[model samples]
Target: MVDIRPDWQLLIDGGKKDSDGDGQRAVVNPATGEEVATVQEGTAADVDHAVEAARNAFEEWSDTSSEERARRLYAIADRIDDHFDELAEIATLENGKPKNQSGNDVFTAVETFRYYAGATDKFYGDVVENSKDELKLKVFEPYGVVGVVIPWNWPPMHTADFISVALATGNTVVLKPAPQTPMSSIRMVELMLDVLPDGAVNVVPGGVEPGVALTNHEDVDMVAFTGHDVTGEAVMKSAAENINPVMLELGGKNAAIVFDDADLEKAVSGAILNAFYNSGQSCASIERLLLHEDIFDDFLAAFLPAIEELNVGEGMDPNSQVGPIIDEAQYDKIQSAIDGAVDGGAEIAAKAESPTDEHLAGGHWVPPTVLTNVDPSMPIMNEEVFGPVLSVTSFRNDDDAVEIANDVEYGLTGGIWTSNLERAHRVAARLETGMVGVNRPSFVSLGLPFGGYKRSGIGRKRDLTETMREYVRVKSIQIDHTDARYSLDLDLAEQRTY
Candidate 1:
């Protein structure tokens, strides 16, 4: 059993501090609607301190050898693995995700760090041959400091995603986690400091004040954010004032296309998982389901039963397959979306009954919901529900499927389920999403770049090589081997002759 703390302090420069006397906010567990912990609510002053510390540490940290950086990253990964259960418990308690899912989040984080650790020595710049007398080289260098803002849904995983790559590329970071779920991130940064130098990683837990300060700070060279689209746009706007580069992984209204030739069982199972995982809080969650006309009925026959069978209760329970929403605001948003869909003439194809357990009565729970006859213009179809609500529509052909899938403003992730190899490639080529799973519901690995295309987001993450490129600036150097006076004289003579 892990010890639940009543209060946690902010981490800055390898030590804990109060939030500049700004006081604290209660961190509630959605599973029980109880205050699991209280964390310092950092202010703009705290943000300034964190950024200054990171800026001060950047020089020495960036100057470290790549091999040494790799060793430290590996050490951090090992420590995460050593304390996996403890971290997972904290994650579940604060984020309201299942114990098993939290464990997987930590596991993915460890692997992500390890993956970037190996790339430390493999990342290289280019040396091109321009002329015999001169040599041209392109060298990569780290941006002095990075400001990272992570969402509450996937705190540890997203935290690791940005910090690991930023640190691996020799960029110090000042991270601001979502106010609702800050303890897990605080603890993760604390563990990271054991291997990293002071100020290499700092955490300022707050709502919007610290984020605004971090993005608009003159010393912060770049900003990486993962959250709602509106907040992401605000972050971009603030960073633009200082001409800082911003990497955003914003909201997604993803779709899944199922063809007649697809495996019914596989498609149904994958679709259910895609729609309901993390209680459907993922940015890449499949909120829209596009089914071919021929397979719509068959798909629903197998899909409804599975969605109905999903168990929803406390995340800590070993038997619970789905957990409560992150907070009351999110729960209300999801409920409103469902009500709006029903009022818009959409039919509820399948909806899981609320849990009967008396202990879970106060929790913010939304059963796995599936809607059919959903029009493309419905808000549930166009907007991001960010819940276990799936809005389904049918397509008569490939063209119709493509049109429906690309109808939304978001192009983050999509799924294509088909047995026809030619059809799969052709359809995938036409889909506007940044990432597509051909036969699988989700396809995310360490090496592949994960990001969105349209309004969903800007830039990518996950791939070590690509992530490093984003965190660094390039400089082109040319060495002149020929005598400058002789060259100038020759040029003048040639000009006179002309």
Candidate 2:
């Protein structure tokens, strides 16, 4: 196993390593309820130092050519690839995701950086043809400094989502990783320092104090945050103080709709994977599954058995498909939601058996739960469970399915399963979500724009071209091409009169 000691330090001004003045905090392992490591808690003062360092580095870094930036990004990606196994082990230990899933997270992060690196030369501004006598050029300039606050659910992958675009577009960054899973981010920054200039990438690991300080700082030009909606609102308010633009990826109550004519086995597998993946800690988890009345019974018969067969244990166990919840609070939330749903007349279709191992008695483990006869209005159906609990409800027809899927505050992701191409296209158009999967589950790709529609989020995340645009400011330059320098002759006389 990778070293689980607490010797990590904050990365400031790219290569400078320093200890936080605020005392240390323990990073707990949710799988075993033990302190995996200890990290220094960054305070408001540390945030100021980080921002100042980033601001100082912005002038030179932003002026560097896109080709050089791309080279540096590729180097970072290579470094990550070299240490992929160690990083994945750290992620699984801290984030409580299964080993394979954590490895996927690392691979995704590496690929994301490489994707942005390849697009460095392709993100170009436009030129408008307004008039023959004047030349109009649109240019994209990097924001001086950007603050990125990443959540713990997807540490390595989410950090890469913002950091790659920001650095590739020539913007310096001050990142604040979640306190729970700071080791991987710290290690990432450490590796990046070999190629990145000082202050080009800095990290402050802590809780609300550092996050608020970073968001409200005067020097930060923009903020990119991914977390719950409640905290997202606060980040927005803080950003508004300086009129700084903020990109938010908030919570979601995603749904998967299964039509009668769809492939039953495919739909069942998609729903199970979408619902229980990462123990349902993902924002795009399909907490609500709307099945057609004609196929509801058949869907459950297949879905329940699959969910029951899933293994739940420690993340390091190769056989474990589902791991423990992140912490006590998350475990309690999952329990409360499940109990509340059952109390509201929802029947439990399937629930996995808890591990009987004596060592796992104190772990924050929750079994995979599938609930049927769920009312669409129930809190478990409408609210984001953020756990391995899938609530199934029946819809009469296509219109009913659309209505049920769209009747929620979140519009992040939805799935449509059907054999009829026309019906799939029609229903996909009606579902109010940022992304829809026709025959499969919703997933992120290199070039696709990923974000939510309604209260789910504020801006997009993926797509190298689109993401680079968000971190930069656009400027339109107009030049007078004509040789004639005709100032109105009458203007002299009019100026004297005025």
Candidate 3:
């Protein structure tokens, strides 16, 4: 068993470590079905201390040039890269995801640092000419303390992405990883201290209470959250009590439309990968598949067989194409969603059966599942199942397909599979999502602005220059140069006023 007692302190500014009493929480290895270690839960007092540390550090850290800040961020990313193998193992053990996926997560984290490192000096404000000889300039300034609540589904990738960008933008951060998957993040923060000030990146591990404290803290200038809509609503409500600014990426029930002229081979492969990637835990995963009636039967014939061939097991297994669900609660939730969809008149195309004892020796495993004959109005089509479950429905034409895709409240992402260039652009225009993937599975990039239109999320993430602006406030300055002796309008304005 991993030692737990040594990790109960908060890393404050200047590398000062302070204990948060003996409040302990166990870290379970979802793959092994056993507790690996225990971490001290941060109390309200601990949060206050961390926030104060950031508040104190901001005075000097904010004054540091963006180049210097970018240098430190690069150092942090390099440190993470040097230990990618070991960190990938930790991610697999705690997150129950494939090792290759873990490595990909690390790559994304590193790329986020690289992307924002170059974007620091690029965040320039504007100059407006309201009148001659009067200059109006806008300057960007970082918010003092930023609170980030990362979800468990993709801990390292999500937490580190937020950490690198927030710090590079000159804002100090306080992060609380989801209780289920917090170890990798704890280690990331521990190593980050070698390059960054301890208080500049504070990590307070605990259950919902610490998250609540951080969200409601009056000193916290801004909040960034990635999680379910219900919890996001609570965070938003609490932050609203203080009228604090927030950036949130909530849940999504994304859609994928398949046209008749599409390549069946490519569509099936992309759809299966889209629906089953990360066991469908991703918010951008395409959960709804809308196929044109002309080729609906042909598409199902190709897709159903692919689902039956998926290899599901532990993350460490080289042969495993799909890994286990994150934790027990998620396992149960996935099961419930599958059963509900079947009960709602959707036919089960292929159900990944419960594995044998050998397969269940470690990890919480679930196989890829697909449903057909699903109606547009079914709960499975509307709700965010967030599992390896895809609901398929048939549409008469491109317009009907787009209508079915836009019927949901979520506007996060949608996939369109069509060979016709005109129809691809035409149908893409009708869908009401923030991001669209035409003839592709997924399209999430570190440089793209990622967010939703409606209930999916609020605000944007990871835009080239806009991300830094999210953590900053604009200060407008106006200078009156009309007093120059040679100014053409200086005395004329004064005489007109007289």
Candidate 4:
């Protein structure tokens, strides 16, 4: 096992390692269903301790110069680049993402650090001239200590999303990494400790207890969470008690719309890549496809054949295009989603063959599948499956496509594929999602804002400058140097002067 010490590890404190006296849990490899590592099953007490440490160090760290913070962030990025391969392998083994995707995820952390490094001073304030007598100066200041809770899909990238920018804006952190994939985050924080203060960043790896504790802690200034919608509700309630602000990134069931005049090849390629990437574990995955009635049959004919060509194998295999489900709960969830859809009259148009290798027998494997005849009201089309399952339906025109796409409770993202530039622009503006790609189904820009309307999330993420603002609070400092008389409705100034 990678982290075999039961008594030695359970919590990572600043630059020190300690045990919570709780216990240890085995980290299973999704590809082989084997124990590949072990991590501490930290308790609530550990979370409290971590938060205390962060609070203690917040003042000094936040007071440091922006240039000094930028220098330290760059050092962390350099360390990540030096050990990219090792971190990627650990992530692949635990998260069941293909090797290349794992590498990209790991590199994403490097990019995030470097991106925010240059943005340490980006959260600029403004000086407003209300009148010559009174001037207002607004400044952005960091929230003392931020509590971050991340999901298991993309640990490396999410670590950067929730932590890197928080640090850039000068907030200390207490991260509760996802239980299923905490090793990589723990490793990432280890690198941060090398360049940051002892209590500037901390990680407590465990199941639900640590997350609950971190969110509920009164000392935490802000909370950033990424996970299921149901769980997000609980976090919101917990933070309510302390009256702390929260940034919730609940997953979504997004849609991809294809028009009759669209380029079939491009639509098919985008659909496959987005639907099956990381076994559809991402919030941006297009869970449903809305095609125009005129081209429904033709699009399916091209898409079905492409879906059948997907390869499912070990995550570490260089040639493997797909990997196993993250765990048993998710495997069962996907299977149930598919079976329920079929029973409800949905037809399976295409299904890739399951892994035939005897070694992967115990792995949580789900075949890449395509479903048709699914009604808009069906749970498979409404609920976030978060699996390699895509449902198809047809729309009449641009208006019809926008209606169907906006019908769901989630407005995280959507795609509109068409050759007509007017329709692309027209329909894109009408969709309810926060971000959209005119011709690309699953396209995302690292520099643009990413979040959703409705239940998908609260607040935005990415674009270093904007995210820097999320971790800070704006303070208005107004100066009054005027001795001149001012217009007052109540005329109370004369009475006060007397």
Candidate 5:
């Protein structure tokens, strides 16, 4: 078992590591089904202290100059770069991400921080055109304290993305990491404290209690969350009592549509990546593969072999391309979904093999699985399996493909595999999703805004003045050139609307 580092968890009021009578929880390694370390769990009371700390620090931190803030944010990015290798390893061991994918998450964290840092001085409000008597303008201001809740998948990257945007927009934060993967996330908050001011960012590591406390806190001006839809619903409902805003990026049952004219090689490659990356634990993965009838057999001929070649084993293996499911419960859930589908007549078209080593026997391994003869109404097809599982369905034409793609409740993201530019644009426009990738999968980055439609999610995550828009509140100011009460300019009887 990996040892615990006392300095790396349960921080409140800036860099102070504080805990109440609540005990620690075991952090598990999904690859071996063993305890990696124990992290202090922050209780509801800890959230109160963190919120208070953030409130006390908000004004001073928000008042800092933009240039200085940029410098400090850049410093945090530099620190992430310095620890990139270490963070990658830590995340892999804890979260069961393949080595390469873990590194990608960390690298994206660096990019996220730098992206928002460069954008510090770039956010702008608007000037209103009005009559000559008065000057009217709008300005953006930060929500004093933001409550952030992130998921277990891609912990470091999600932590970096959410917190950087909040701090960049001059908001103080109270962050809560998922119970499944808290070590690296708390370590990340520790690194940020080295550069950011005390209390500017605080982290509480725990299960549901801390998250509920943070979201329901009256002092938190806004709440940002990324997770499953059920939890997001609770968060939104709780925060509504105070009428504070919420930014929710929830789950997805994304689709990948392959047209008849698609480049088979490229389509197959992207489909493979989408179906199996991070053991298909990504919300943006192609949960459903809709293929043109003309290319259905041809695509599977190439796609099935690729799935078999992917290595499913320990995360640290240099050759490993797939990792275990996050835990036993999730493992069983995915298995049940597959079993139920098969019992309901869905056939297992192909499945990859996991490492046969006895040490890996304890791991919650989910081989890359593909299901054929699946009905759109099947639970596996409609619900989010969130495992290395793919279901294939054939479409006769464009309209059928779009209908099948849009059939699910989730519209987080989808892709079109076609070489024709016009068809790509036309179909992409028709698809129901927040983002689409033509001929390839879209990468979540600093440039493109990320979110979903319908039950998928609530808001976008990007550095656009628009993604930056949600982090801030707008206030309008009016200045009258004449310093008069203006009672003479208006007649009460004429102005009255009976």
Candidate 6:
């Protein structure tokens, strides 16, 4: 067993401060099934300190030119590249994702930063046409400080991407990583300190106390969060007290509609990958699959065996197709959801069996599961199940597919599979969602805006141009030249006809 107790983590305030204390949480390695380290947990007071540091730093950071901001961002991206291997190891150890997946996610996160870095110099507010004599202007300026609540499923990608965009837009940040996965995020903060200006970025990792404190901090100007709908709601409720602007990428009970004209093999492959990737913990994972009645049997024929043959093992194993769930709590949730579906009269197509092997038995591992004969109204279909479970239902035609697709209250994303281009557009347009994919399972993009419509979430992320807008408030500057040129006509005595 690897020794885990080490003086490893510290609260990153600006560029300094190792606020270690007795309050610590164990960092578990899901692959090897061991506790890697006991990281220090931050308190509400700590959040105050971090926010103060960021607020102070914003004074200088906000004044920086777009070019200078871009340069600093690129430098930070370079630092991330230098430490990619070490970061990936930390991510794999802490998050239990495959080593390759961890590495790729890190790479993607760096690329996201690099993209924003380049964008900072290129994009700025345009000059709107205003009346002559006096100059009327609009400027985009940074919010004082931003609070980011990072989720656990893809910690590095989500946190890094948000941090990059937040800083590029000239906003300082006080970030709180999820309690379950904080080491990877802390290491990211360590890397940031090497390049970022002092107090430009701060990280405090802990449980609900710190998160709640960070969100409700008086100094925090805006909130950017990625997580489940339930927690998203809580964040919004908290923000309402202050009327804080928020960008939320929340949960989804996404559906993948397969039309009869679609290629069965392609649709089946897309569904399997999207529904089960990241242990089905992805926000955009297609949990409810709506199949056309004509091709329903054929679709199941190919999909069932593919799921059954998926190799379930440790995330680090190169051959492992399905990895362990994040933790015990998530495992229990997955089990409960499956049981709930079964009780609702849904047929289990393939249930995940517990492992007998000693190595796999201790970790939170679950096999890929599938359920059919699902009703659209079932709780399992209605709710977001962030696990390796797929619930499928059948539709008669295109109209039926749209009805079933839009049936869910959560509308973050959905997919349509069809060879016909016209039908794909029509169906995709009909789905009341923030994003939808046709003939594709995944719609995550680095340039497009990502968010939900209804209970899933409000606001968006990743539209560098649009995201910058969220971080700024428009100030209207009215010229008095119009008043001089034309007298006020509010009263009959002051009225003038020109």
lDDT minimum window of 10 residues, candidate 3: 1-10
Residues 1-498 of candidate 6 have per-residue lDDT tens digits of: 223346455455555454544588887866556787877788887888888889888988988888998888888888888888887777777887777778888898889888989888765665565656565667677777999998888888887778888898889998899877887777777777857778888888888888898778777999888887788888888876878888888888898988999999999999988888877888888898988889889999888988888877676677767678888888899889989989989988975454456766678877889999789888998888798999998998888888888888889898989999999888888998888988888566778887778877887777777766777767666455654544455576555675
TM-score, candidate number 2:
0.96
Show the colliding residue pairs in model 6: 14-199
lDDT (tens digit, per residue) of candidate 3 on 247-312: 989888999999889998999999988998888999999989888899989988888877888877
Model 4: residues with Cα > 4 Å off, grouped in runs: 1-12, 130-134, 482-498
Candidate 3 wrong stretches, greater than 4 Å: 1-9, 14-19, 130-132, 357-362, 484-498
TM-score of 5: 0.96
The numbered model that scores best in TM-score is 1
Q: Distance from true position, residue 248, model 6, in Å?
A: 1.6
Q: Compared with the true structure, what per-residue lDDT tens digits does model 2 show for residues 217-289?
A: 9989999999999999999999999999999999899989899999999888888888899999999889888
lDDT of 4 by residue, 200-270 (tens): 89898888788888999999999999999899899999999999999988878889999999999998999
C-alpha local distance difference test of each model: 0.89, 0.89, 0.82, 0.86, 0.87, 0.81
Q: Which candidate ranks first by lDDT, i.e. highest?
A: 1
Candidate 1's C-alpha runs over 4 A off are 130-132, 486-498
Q: What's the TM-score of every candidate structure?
A: 0.97, 0.96, 0.93, 0.95, 0.96, 0.94
All-Cα superposition RMSD per candidate:
2.0, 3.2, 3.3, 2.9, 2.4, 2.5
Worst 10 residues of 6 by lDDT: 1-10
Q: Candidate 3 has which clashing residue pairs, if any? A: 31-363
- The 10-residue segment with the lowest total lDDT in model 1: 485-494
lDDT of 6 at 271: 93
Candidate 3: deviation at residue 201, Å?
Answer: 0.5
Ranking by lDDT: 1, 2, 5, 4, 3, 6
